[model samples]
Target chain A: MRLKATNIEHFYGHEKILHGIDLEIEPSKITAIIGESGSGKTTLLAILSSLLKPTNGDVYYDDISENSIKDINAFRRKNIGFVFQFHYLIEYLTLKENIALGAFDEHNINTLMENLGIGHLANRYSNEVSGGERQRAAIARALVNKPSFVFADEPTGNLDTKNAVGVFELFKSFNDTTFVVATHDKKIIDYADVIIEMEDGVVKCISKKRV
Target chain B: MITPLKALRKNWFKTLLIFISMTVSISAIFLISAISSGVVGMYSTMLKTDGDIIVTQKGIADTFFSDINRSLEPKIINLAGVKELNSMIFGASPVDNLPIVAIYGVSANRLDNYKLISGIYPKNDEVLVGEKIYKMLNSPKKIKISKQEFKVSGVFKSKIGFEDGGVVMGLNDASKIFHKNASMMLISLEDIEAKDMVEKINNLSDDIEAKTTDNFIDNYNQFKIIKTSSDIISALAFLMGILGIISMMSMVVNDRKVEFGVMRSVGLSSTAIISRLIAEAIIISLFAYIAAIALSYIVLEVIQNIQKFQGYINGEITPQLAILVFVISIIMAIFGSLLPAIWASRIDPMSLILGGSK
Candidate 1:
């Protein structure tokens, strides 16, 4: 799905977080928003995924206005998926149940866990696993529905280099879905198809990878 | 389903306390109402003889304290709707070291077969001794009442505790021994209602009047206050159950806010998540209700089997009332968790996911 944003502006209370931001995302491509802490990368990703509404601009899905959709929750469940930075796996649920939350299909769970190399931790609760394992489980959850667009806010920020690379390689195998990642990690940015650098709530530069 | 259960397991002790309090509140209401109902029923039956209307002195509160003489009795028998009248003279005589022996002296008509539990009714200076009083005697066959020797012709039982330990004999023997007259008269009516006859009897004289079961109960001021107080206690016990369960569930919901937020992020709809929490609540309520029933039954049986309390009252909750009380408990849990569950569903994944608020 192609997403085009025109003049997106956001404010948290009286403080502006995103100022007149504009961007375009192509279908079936990995777009990375790179910035340091307090740089509005996560805020932009949240707005684009329809998890948050910007204060002053509109987001369109394939040029169809998002505001016209009656049930935004249904829309997100059907199209967009999210992976948070903290590996916020529900402490009460095992890795498997967390991933398959109303995904409408369970046949792919075993294969999906095996693909993420978290098959051993499928039945283990979040507390029983290491930090890297929890991060991988969060990614598995974002992809369980095979969503057309997957948004991640520092998906591998909590992982070591080897585990971070492993998580990045897992994203490379998704041929049908687009990956929109917000992170400051150099290793994750190396695999980006397009990198939008942000500084002080504004886009600073746009860099594309050479194939 | 398993998600909520696992979360609840983390706070099992608190949850168990909620269940315990729920059971306690329900059982308390049941026990209190049962005992009050039983006591009211016992007194009501003992005071309510086989008559549509009872005639007594106007100021008397209890039927046992009424002492309208035979002068008022003939006037009552000649009333328009009067079919038959039975006069009962009752007194408490301290006999055989038992300070309170309720004695009933019946007029010629002792035809109320329900009062006789075993053998023939008293005849020829004989008496029917109460089952409890007979048990207290060395020889159950005979007993001395009013300083006169009388054979214990039969044993009788009355659900009322006072009458269950009393004696019954002829009216002539009572007046001859105690030199006192009738205390109350049990009057039966034909076509007119007892209250109508009561109105006529009151118009006839100021010394005595007639009262149906309802009028007597209205004037039974002591028990009226007790009934009112017991009803409020019963209602408060029910309220305690509702509030306790709701608060417990609400607190549980508060503690699991982040977990619910995480679940919402995983694509579970608000309805799905709320239903899961409600399902967990129903399971808890069901277990607690079952435990309440079983424990109440055992405790009630134990109370009833005790020697002094054997015939008092059983605290068995009616199936309908039990189901209703348990349903209210579940509804309390539902209301308790509902708002919090909805709040959890609406939790911004931004705050919880990014640790932004922290």
Candidate 2:
């Protein structure tokens, strides 16, 4: 599915965070949104993923605008998944249970955990596992539902360079699903098919890499 | 997929606080209900007589204070369906150091209701002491009432609550001591249907009123007051319990806001989250109710064993009371969780995740 945002604008009280942003996320590709602090990377990622309703303009999945959908939650539940900077796994639940939160078929959870290379840690709590392993579990949870689009906001922000590269490799391996990662890490440019760089609250440049 | 048990287990301290609050509140309700029921039960047993109808002073609030002229007994006995009439005087007097001791003065025929435990029936200056009173008085051979000394002829026990903690003597002696003619008269009927006889007896004298045993018990004002007061107190305690649950659930929801946001971000609907919270509240209430029942039962047993309450208070946790507690618990769960559930359903996931990010 194609995700498109048209002239998106956002405000936090009196201050404008995003200004007239236009972008199209191609299907089955990794689109990296890179910017410095206070550049509205997280806000734009939130707006594009339907997590936040834009102050002005709209986001569309294929030909259907977000405004046209009667139940935005139902829409998100059926098609969207999110991975935050902090893994955001429930402290009481095990990794497998956390992953199962997004799973339509619980039976597929074990195989997905195994594919994420954290199957052995499936029964470990989020606090019990290492940071890299926890982030892997978060990724597994996001993809467990087989959503068409996975929006990750600085998913590797807390990980070391080796673990961050490993996370990008995991996104690369999942070729059938589209991933939109908003981050400060320049390392993601190596793995992304499309890189959209931002300055202040506006897009500075867009670069496409040859496969 | 959202099970409440995991959250409860993880937050055991909060769960324990809520559990203790609910248990204490529910136990208060159950204990008050049991004691009230016991009071009514004791009165019912004491009021039981072999006669079909009872005659007492008209418009009296308590039968203990009823004063009917002894001359009316002849008229009551002559009424149709009247096979026998027994006059009795009831009063309360301090004996020795005891604060209040129930005194029943009846004719020898009324002695049939008591089972002799260690002594014969009393006459004139002699009195039969109740088993409990005898023990409380240290099995004394004599007890003084109203500046008059009487020999303790024997000890007796009875199913009637008043008879087990009271003194029984001849009606003439009681009249002399209490300075009253007679408190009430019990009339036995040849036929069980005594409704007409009651009316006839009532019309015979202006000071006396007649009532079937069932009618007399149903209209007893003391029992009604006791029951109403108990119910009001129990309701207040139950309300406190509900408030405790609401406060606890609201705190839990506030503490888990970020968790709820994560859940929403992962595709769980707001309704699903609220349902999970309600389920948790209900589960906590159920456990607390069970604990309260056990606690109330223990407290009741301790009370029943106390010397002052022995034979007079037989507190039991009836099935109806248990079921009532269960129903109240469910109500507490639902009402308690309503506001918190609404608050939980309205949580915006985007802001929480973004807030955590920045």
| Interface RMSD after interface superposition, model 2 | 1.4
Best by DockQ: 2
**Local accuracy by lDDT, each model:** 0.76, 0.86
Task: Give the per-residue lDDT of model 2 (tens digit) for A98-185.
Answer: 8987577899888988898999998899999999999999999889888899999999999999999999999999988999999888
Worst 10 residues of 1 chain B by lDDT: B307-316
Stretches of candidate 2 above 4 Å error?
B49-52, B83-86, B159-162, B186-198, B308-313, B355-358
lDDT by residue (tens digit), candidate 1, B77-126: 88778988887787777656555577888886853533666778787688
For candidate 1, the lDDT comes to 0.76
Q: Which pairs clash (backbone N, Cα, C closer than 3 Å) in model 1?
A: none
- The sequence of per-residue lDDT tens digits that candidate 1 reaches over residues A89-157 is 777678898888757798898899999889988899989998888988888888888888999888887
TM-score of chain B of 1: 0.73
